[model samples]
Target: MCGIVAATAQRDVAPLLIAGLKALEYRGYDSAGLAVLDGGQIRRVRAKGKVREMEALYRADPFPGGTGIAHTRWATHGVPNEANAHPHVAGRVAIVHNGIIENYADLRARLQAGGRAFTSETDTEVIAALVDERLAAGLDLREAVLAVVRELEGAYAIAVIDRNAPGRVVGARRGAPLLVGLGIGENFLGSDAQALVQVTHRVIYLAEDDVVEITRESVRIHTLDGTPVERPVHESELSADAVERGEYRHYMQKEIFEQPRAVADTLEARLGPHGVLPNIFGAGGDELLAKVRGLHIVACGTSYHAGLVAKYWIEEYAHLPVGVEVASEYRYRDAVVPPDTLFVAISQSGETADTLAAMRESKRRGYLGTLAICNVPESSVVREADLRLMTRAGPEIGVASTKAFTTQLAALALLALQLAHQRGLDADRYAGLCAQLAHLPRAIEDALALEPAIVALAERFIPRQHALFLGRGVQYPVALEGALKLKEISYIHAEAYPAGELKHGPLALVDESMPVVAVAPGGPLLEKLKSNLQEVRARGGELIVFAEGEAGMDGNPARGALLRVASGGDFIAPAVFTVPLQLLAYHVAVLRGTDVDQPRNLAKSVTVE
Candidate 1:
């Protein structure tokens, strides 16, 4: 994923664009660039590093213009360098793009045949040159964009500004995220609302194949065929504080602690004192729930782990057969998504490339109903789905997700309870679980107090090159997420194994140098988890246990550290127990001197496959 921000007829927009880019830097930080229409010519500046570096470069050689487009790139087709940065310019056209053009090689060959030269080895540069070629052949900016898009085949959100049309910017999205911020006098375009939230909260989320022509005072929407279309502009209720880190050392840490507030927010206004969902989805819910034969939970990364936990919840409570698939793999497999099957996509950013693509495929295949559990209200996933469950985890700034994952679990758990009620499952059991769910925020607050101990534990393990995480049942997904967070930020060689699976193959790697983080929550699997911990301890592996406050350790001297979560009911423990693991990863990464906000080789959003 990359971040894009464009503004037309906005004087001194560079500073604003930079601020927006900084807000979006979590999405990408490999390189940053900006292109402004200056004196009827394109003026571009780029830096090979973070947004701050680009800001310094731009300040030294100011590219003053009223209309501009900026990008913070996550390297895809090329190395992370100034030459490979976005706002790729070709002749009079400058372009900033998110997503990949799969047919770029063929397009490059055809363009080379036409004697078009390329500078950077990026698929985005090909788009800029193609637009430039079309513009030279008597097509206007919008016409050229449409023509070029016709030749492309891939997911992309392209925003172009031509020197000849200094006041106009054309943006097109095909299976990628693009939003138009409805501001006074000056209009804005960004890959996400976070990029434009500071300037305007009113936005129009562009659908696939929708092209927007933005000028100083007006925004026109049209189909690829040039027919004018109407789109709804919605006001976002997101507050400025939602995006702030407050007093935490890093956004990751702040997000870890915000899990309590976020979970509370997701549960608010929907559930009553009796633990009933307030008929939110209405008639659609009944119709869909009645006919649903099975469910396909599609997501990527941490969201995928959430779906794993959801499978347990829904199957146990809702009595529904559920399959949790990695979105990227789900589309290509011979999986069955019947007409009455419910397709649920989980994503924090909502612009997750594979998840969005999988959702589209499910719709094309005629899934009964599509639902998106997302954090962003009007994100592509939310807009495309028939029903939306918005997680109230506001702007997750860390590249490796923390609060968003927990919030998604909280929302999905509630949805499971709702489904259980509709399906006439054990109502009392479901109600008890819901009551526990309601107390999760407070349990999470208590869990967050373990951070100081976790930070101390992290100091002993951050320097280790290899680590392993193990858990059983629902905690397996948390173990996977914990391992992922460590690998994502700290560059540690970490792997998660369902405790039972360790004996199959992974036990061979356990040694003195390997640190094993075991999620041994108090449950039926507690003894098995303890046995697994002992297996690691027998192999001279360091052990870190995440257990309840009263969990008995059986006097194992090998239990190097214990992160005791506050005592809570079993149903709420996942939400609360996840807090310490998130802090452990964050503190470890920070101690390793890694960029905690924008991790290397990772972007906040997975907008491209």
Candidate 2:
């Protein structure tokens, strides 16, 4: 989950590299470093902690050059320390890499046998050494990089600087993400387009195994095999404001409040007089949905939770069996493959490793077709899938997802309606669901209005050690998501169980000190869920319920505590209910004084498995 930013320009490139790294800090890194070719030598600085430390070091003693590469590393091969940080230099070459090199030990041994000295405990250093060795053998910077990449294995997106080639930076990618930003008389590279948005809005995303050579006045793209290639430069639609934190204390909070607008944006063009548009998922999607015998979803983390919610929607509306699995586990197992099952892959950043692999596996095993529900349009997952539904939530900066998840649910809701419509469900019923969807943005806004009350409730949870979330029917996934948010940001131990499953094991953990959160939407299952809450209450468990409509528990002492969030419809309740939980997590983390945006041991997009 490392971040890479490199630049070759007419002016000093260190400042631009620093700004790019700052833009990518939300991806979560443990260390930062930079390398610049100055005075025919690779000058480098590394810091074990935040980018600010690296910035301070650079301000004190800057490494100024026309070309440079920088990295914010989330450690994998070695500990997070100055020695283990990136921009690993060897001889005249400095390299910053993302993703692990699978055969580094063998490469390191070969290099050591060649009498090459290593200064850092990193596979990246081995890469630099190999490249330097190739350079020593009369290969130019581009050729050296290409030669070394052929000998390496596993995912990597690397930027290399050769002191011999003063004004150029060579970058190559395989499994990890890398893109080039186009600017007048300059060129840029970043692990994410966000890192380059401030400098240039035009970008070219590199395909796997594509190598790029960048200079102050020109850029050339080629395959790893040395054949020239061309890639389209698209004008990025993301504004600088989307990635900035304005009034909110953290990006997570800003994202939480952006859900209403996100959902509104996602619903655009998908709704009309015809209920749900048949072609919202792109061409031929309606026909595929009409023919599929079953549905299977593959995703990881928050996307998986979104899939869990989609399971209920698809099964209920489309009258088709739905199965959901964690993408990591799904790819490794010998699971049953149903014929004509519609495969769906969901991710906020289409670069999630496990999810992308699972999508490939599903496609290989012969599904009806694959659909990618993702936020970014040109992501790997969307590019490979047969049909695509872009969430259009824009850029999600926070590690803990908010707008992305809500927008994903909105997209899946559209899919569910399309399936129902094609399955010959009642026309009036479909139109009614569309009407409810039209009201979702406003309902999310109303739920956001309940933030103050949710914040007050969060203060009560600050000192608690554990929390249990409960819901029945479709709200079960909502409960799971709420628990995930609490545990992820606040560092509180939390678990979720279906209300009916309480007696199986979770009920035993209930006590006076434990707070039990219930997603009580007051549908047919409300009375049953109340009975489950009574079991918790009987055990002296403190109760917090996010109720929809009047559950008769308002101001009732038996309920312990209640917060009402606007329930647009049961179809849209997941999106509405998510607002308060996100608020609760934000407030609790703030109260606990934890890092709200970048949580410990987590990255925004899991690029490496």
Q: In model 2, what is the error at residue 535, expressed in angstroms?
A: 0.5
Compose the digit string of candidate 1's lDDT tens values, residues 1-609: 898999986676788789889888888889999988889888888999899999998899886788899999999999999899999999999999998999999999999998988889999999999999999999999999999998889889989999989789999998778989988889999988888888899999898899999998999999888889989999987667777878987888877877888889988987777775665554376567667778999999899999999998888877889999999999897787665789999999888889988998887787888989998877888888888888889888888888898899888887887888878877678678878888888888888888778878899776699999998998899899999989988989899999999889999998888888888778888877777777877888778888874234553354477766764787766667777888888889889999888877888788888
Error of 2 at 339 (Å): 1.9
Candidate 1 has a TM-score of 0.96
For model 1, give the 10-residue run with minimal summed lDDT. Answer: 549-558
Q: With candidate 2 superimposed using the best TM-score fit, by how many Å does residue 39's alpha carbon deviate from the native?
A: 1.3
Clashing pairs in 2: none
Number of the predicted model whose TM-score against the real structure is largest: 2
> After aligning candidate 1 to the native by TM-score, how far in Å is the CA of 1 from where it should be?
1.2
**Stretches > 4 Å off in candidate 2:** 549-559
Candidate 2, 469-511: lDDT as tens digits: 9989888888899999999999999998999999999989988
